[model samples]
Target chain A: MKRWIPVVLVYIALIAWLLFSVFPFSTTLLIALKPKNAFMKFPPDYFSMKLTFENFKIVLSDKNWIKYYTDTIIIATLSAALSVLVGSLAAYSFARYEFRSKEFLMVFILALQMIPAASVIIPIYSMFATMNLLDTFLILILVDSVSSIPLIIWLMRGYFSTIPKELEEAAFIDGCSGMKAFWAVTFPLAAPGIAASAIYAFVRAFNDYIMARTLAGDRVVTYTVGLTMFTNQYEGVDLTLVSAAAFTALIPILIMFAIFHKHFIIGLTGGALKD
Target chain B: MKKRKWIPILLIVPALALLIFVMMFPLGWAFVTGLKSMTLLDLMTGGGRFTGLKNYFKIFRDRLFYNSLRNSLIFVSISVIGQVFFGFLIALALKNKFVRFKSFFRGIFLLPWIASSVIVGYSWIYILDANLGFLPTLASVSPFLQMLGLNRKDWLTNPSIVIYVMSVINIWKGMPFSMLMQSAGLQSIPDTLYEAARVDGAGAWQRLTKITIPLMTPFILINLIMTTMITFNVYDVILVMTSGGPNHASEVLSLYVYNTGFTMGELGYASALSIILLLVNLLVTILYFMILRYRERRLA
Candidate 1:
């Protein structure tokens, strides 16, 4: 009876979580298919008397969406690639080398994670405006990469530290240069960790709003900022259209998670707890 | 090892340079901007004069600033505590052997966190919408509650309760992370420890208290600190949900800073607030490290 109590509680909690999480997604899907007038009924009809694909078609065919989606994809991909390359190198250095200010640098990098993006948004905006790079994809990529570097480094550093030094030492003994050893031996072994860090950087870049909103403005809107267009303060909000856009935005992330589930899980949770 | 000296330096240079140029420089610039008496025109045209601590003093005198800070602290505290408590409970349940389809449950549970905060905010807005919301409908439908004749509450409209509404959304989104960390911590403990306790006739509660709690301390501390930082820094959810509305009752520190700099065009005052947030985060980090060290020494 005592054991059964905990089991019952687990089921109860799972049901509660399901209602909270899945219910929203289902409601969103339902809303996306409903006619605009049906969305505002007094009882708020869940089922559309006549389902329509008009919202989806509109969102998909919009010219601005094409540019927004392309800009987001480019930014996410570039930031992920740059963060992985730079972060892996720095992680390897921290793992393999004993140098002056090593601890200080490590701590400093960790502390960088604490700096709120909001705090720097104004200065970053002004600085970018001065450089004439505001609203450029390059600025978005640079901002995303900078923000993601610390996380990638932390993950890579933790994973690299776990790998034995002797493997690289063996490569060095075989007349491989230090760079060659890292590339041929250490890096390949740390591929899983690298993949994990890359995916993380990608997700962060994709989901980020403040920097993208501040830097890109309307010129290079990301998926997050694009969704904001549906919300105007004084206008009548079409919940159906907004829901459709949100559902569409989630597809890429869900697909990415599906493709790299194991690596993503290990990378994210391992980095969080271990470090 | 001779070439190694420069190789490591070379490896670190690009990341360091990018970080400094993109992140660190802007932060430094914000500090400098805070010390200047710059109007938006002056800042835009590069004709600002120096004004030391004047913006900072102005923020202190502004009542909205204190309200934002207070709301931020309250929101963070409630969200963090709720996530951690529920997370611990979920972790305990997952550790049980009888739980079916564990991996499927874990994946679905993480949906709230993985979904964008803007999406979550909008979703909750639907769930809490006054005329067409689910919660009010459900509340009105319950036979037990209907018998009591309690009125359906307008959760979003009330300034005093909006933070709690926001907190619920945050906890739902964030609790999965703490659960994942705790589960990982749980996996690290050897089964033999539990076996020995069982052989010694210790009850399940005793084993949980004596073994699991102690082993999970490090993970709990890490999750707590990270959650606090996240809650404090959050803006997207608040932006989408309330935009610090109902007379700025739900306005958080970060959102306040954003508005000050961008909306009000008070660059200097916003910079000061940003600096304060940075210092607060730094202090929190230091405090966490100190506690960790103290725990390590006590254990030793």
Candidate 2:
């Protein structure tokens, strides 16, 4: 009985948490299917009468959404790729090299992570405006890639450090150059870490709004910014339209998680645990 | 081996170059901008004169600056505390041996962390809308409470309650990260310690107090620091829900800096405010590291 009591409590607590976390999403889903008038009903219509595709149809038909989705995908993919490429090299360096200021550089990179983008958004905006790079996908990709470099470097460094030095030494002795040896031997071993970092970089770039809003303005709006338009116009707060948009925005992430669930979990937990 | 020494440096150059261009350059530019007299036109056109410390002085004189700082501190403290405590409790409960379906529960609990902040803000807005919301429904269900004359309040619009509402939303969004961290920490603790305490006839409460809390200190501290830093820097939710309106009651330091620079066109003064925020974050990070080092030494 004593042992079972704690078990029951834990189950109860978990159920409560699940309800809290999932209720809003389910509510949004329900509201999306409801008729326009059903949104504000006092008794709260749990189910929709004559399920309508109007909200989804309207959201999909919007001209700007295609551009927004395209821009988001482009930025997220390019940033993730760039972050992984640069971060892998830097991580390899940190793993193998015994240089002066190595620890300092690593800590400096960590400190850089602490600097909020909001604190620097103005300066970045001004800089981009001068350079005429505002509203360019290049700016979004560049900012996200740099912001994600530290974690990628750290995670890759952790993964690379665990690989035996003997493998690299053997490859070098067998006539492979240092770079070639790393590419052939160490890179494959660290693929999981690289994959993890890529997902993170992609997600960060995909989900980021502050930087996107500041840098791109309306010209290169991401899906997040596109979603914001639903609210800013404020025509009686179309719950159904907003819900459909929210769900649309969430689908890609959910799909990514589904496809790369193992890598995502490994990457996130691995990075946190190592820290 | 000798040739290989520079290879790492060569490999690291791209990342370093990108960082310097994106992060370091803007950081230096911000400081320089803060030291200059720059209008929005001047900033946009790259034609501004240096006027040292004047913006800093003006920022100090601004009443909104101090109010933002105070509100930020209060919001961060309360939200961080709530998140960490609840997260720890939930983690502890989940870590118990008898807990069933742990992975399913954890995944569900983690939904908030992954959900977009904009969506969470919007959902809460729907939930708290005074005219038509679930809370009003719940309130109406209890006639005794309705008879007690409790008026429904528009939580987001009220200045006094806006900060608290924001804090609740922040906590809801943030607690999952802390929960994951605490659960990970719990995994590292050895089961034998708990078993030995049980064998000693120690009650369940004693076993938990003696074995669990001390072991979880590092994770708790880490979560505290991270959450505090994050809460202080929060913006997306505030921007979505309130936009620092109703007399700017929910204006945090970061948001204040944003509004000053972008909305009001006070570029120089905004830069000063940004610097102040940087200093505060630096202080918090230093304090955390100091405590961590002290604890490490004592443990060693």
Choose the strongest candidate by TM-score.
2
Q: What is the TM-score of chain B in candidate 2?
A: 0.94
Each model's lDDT: 0.81, 0.81
Kindly give the stretch of ten consecutive residues in candidate 1 chain A with the minimal lDDT sum.
Answer: A228-237
For all candidates, the clash counts are: 0, 0
Error of 2 at A242 (Å): 1.7
Clashing pairs in 2: none
Candidate 1 lDDT, B18-96, residue by residue in tens: 9888889999998998888765566658867788888889877989888988988899999999898888878777878
The local lDDT score (0 to 100) that residue B64 gets in candidate 1 is 89
Q: Candidate 1 lDDT (Cα, whole model)?
A: 0.81
Off by over 4 Å in 2: A40-50, B137-151
On residues B20-95, what C-alpha lDDT tens digit does candidate 2 reach at each position? 7888888888998889877677876678788899888887788998889888987899899999998998888877
